[model samples]
Target chain A: MKYTEEHEWLRIDGDVVVVGITEHAAEQLGDVVFVELPEIEAVVAKGDEVCVIESVKAASDILAPVDGEIVEVNEALSDNPGLVNEDPQGDAWFFKMKLDDLRVLDDFMTEDEYKDFLG
Target chain B: MSEHSTELKQTPLHALHLELGAKMVPFAGYSMPVQYPMGVMAEHLHTRAHAGLFDVSHMGQVILTPKHDMAALEAGLEALMPVAVSGLAEGRQRYGMFTNAQGGILDDLMFANRGDHLFMVVNAACKAEDIAHMKAHLADVAQVQPVTDRALLALQGPQAETALAALVPDVRAMRFMDVLSVDTLFGALWISRSGYTGEDGFEISVPATTVVDFARLLLDRPEVAAIGLGARDSLRLEAGLCLYGHDIDTGTSPVQAGLVWGIQKSRRTGGAREGGFPGADCILAELADGPAQLRVGLHPQTRAPMREGTEIWDASEGGQKIGCVTSGGFGPSLGAPIAMGYVDSGHASTGTPLWGEVRGKRLPVTVCDLPFRPSTYKR
Candidate 1:
């Protein structure tokens, strides 16, 4: 698993990368109320804001970590956005991205580096 | 720390807030808590269910003492605003606003008649200007002294009375908007059975020295929890209350803001005393003929929240721009997004379909009656 500077974590699945916000990000955004997911199979750039997250306090956007195509999204978030707060890095994974090269994940932060980045 | 953080003012309960693990943020030049460890959603639900204690000491408190008699001060004050301050009975509080020459609201305030003197609480951001305005206008008739040695705390919820009455048994007799000065173990508490939240509650003004102890006394009760500014905003939004600098501002008139009810008949056209306040011509004419735009509640059809600055359109795909949302967020109690904004008078009716432009998409919204939930104020 690797973490982006934007507090997003990516884990390599079979042929795709599962993307979700880190636990620190979920804790920062109090209670998640709504999540606007990107369309499946949409090509996204590294800086593209793919998802919008609304908490009781304010709204935040989830940026794509790397250039990829969205293959799958967590539809469960439509019924219960609070899952982001309950299990940010587990069941709350936002989407799966099919990247040309999974080697791009090596450029992201390690678990220990993410912890220091949070501090 | 940022230079702005160093300049931020601290409330009397600042230390206590840090002790409670509050995430402090800059609000109106004050270092205030936006939420505690419990978060905004939990605090909002807690306030609705049981009780929530709020530290509102950043708001300005002022005392206006008449130079000669109470009537003199009332007349001086009435000359500035449209409210009926002359007939405010002793130990009663009334909501008011300071108006500008253009009829725009300078600040919304709550003033209570304390027999010989009048006690007023105004918004923190507008405190300096509000004080100058009062002094410049009524210095001859009243002594406008801002109270700096007091802290204001709001205990609000369905169970607020039970927690407050436990501290001062006399609070049981007070109805909504009733104000009283009672002696307590902490200090002399100047309490009013009024609050920003629509719940039955009390706003207690205690000495700054003993305010921490007073807040602790209320928090000791199982029903009371420490609430923060984040939940306070959501609570007021759900209650359909206007927030200063948001729902109402220097450019928004009272009539357009749906605050005409605050103007008593005594100050209206064909009343006992009419048209003495600033911008009386514009305000009175709007009162009689109705404003071009009216502030109305907006209920988004989707789960996505249409926050402040979202444009309201007449059609789903941007046919014509109507107005804009002023205050909006996800309401915890309602489990949905709620908002209030100005719209053309023709589109102000309840159930009228409207569209709020969030991000780049036009989301369907409806003009709904204010107060997404029923207010539980004890009459």
Candidate 2:
């Protein structure tokens, strides 16, 4: 598992990278009320904003961690946005991306390093 | 986390907010709690179900006493706002606004007739100017004294009576809009049976020194929970209440904001005390002729919140801009997105269909009657 500075966590599953926000980000956002997911098969850059998350307090954006194509998204979030706050790193995974080369993930922080980065 | 963190004012309950793991944010030049550990959603729902305590110490509290007699002070107040200050029966409070000569609202406020004197509560952001405005206009007839040693707390919800009456039994006898001072073990509590939330509640003004203890006593009840600014806003919005600086502002007139109810019949045309206040000509004319724009409730057809500043367009495919949203967000109690904004009078009907542009997409919105949910005031 890897984490980005933008408070997103990525996990490799076969040839896809499952991406979701970190627990820290979810806690900061308070309660999630609405989520606008990106379209499946949409090509995105490393820094592209692909998702919009609205909480009871304010709205936030989820940036694509690395360059890839959005292959799948968590449709469950549309009906139950609270899942993002309930399980941010697991069932709350936003989408899966098909990266051309998975080695690019090596540059991201590991779980231990992400904790230090959060500090 | 603003750059002027050191300059922000702290309420008497600041330390207690921190102890409860509240997320403090800068609001109206004060370091206040935006939410507690329960979060905004839970806090909002909790207030609807039971009772929620809010520390509104940042709002301005002023006492206006007549140097000569109460009648003279009533006239002094009548000259500043459109409300009927003279006929405001003792122990009753009324909503009012300071208006500019052009008929625009300077600030919305609540003033109660406490028999011997008037107790006025103004918004925090406009406190300094509101105080100065009152002194400049009514100094010779009334003594405008700002009360800085008191903290205002709002106990709102269906169970508010159950929670507060347990401590101050006198409050149970008070009806909506009733104002009285009661003595308790804590101190002399100046309380009013009213609040911004559309709920049966009380707004208590307690001495700043003993506010923390009083807040803790209320929170210790099983029916009470500490709410924050975040939920306070959502609750008020759901109740169809206008927030100062939003929904209504210095550029909006009382008539355009649909606040004509605040103006007593005596102040209108052909009344006994007609045309004595500021902007009386424009306000009265608008009241009779009807305003060009009307503030109405907006119900977004989707789950996404259409926040403030979202433009409202006619329902046509390529329609002209008619208005802009002033207060918009998710309605926790209703489980959908609700908003209030100004629109052309032609499209202000309760069932009229409109369109609100959000983030580059035009979403369907309907002009619904205010207070998406029915207010449960103890009338």
Report the number of the highest-DockQ candidate.
Answer: 1
- Candidate 2 wrong stretches, greater than 4 Å: B1-6
**DockQ metric, candidate 1:** 0.96
The list of candidate 1 runs beyond 4 A from truth reads B1-6
The DockQ values of the predictions, listed in order, are: 0.96, 0.88
Tens digits of per-residue lDDT for model 2, B28-124 = 8999999999989889999999999999999999999999999999998889899888988999998999998989888999999998999999999
True contacts kept of 2: 0.83
Q: By DockQ thresholds, what CAPRI class is model 2?
A: high
| Candidate 1: tens digits of C-alpha lDDT, residues B34-135 | 999999999999999999999999999999999999998999999999899999999999999999999999999999999999999999988988999999
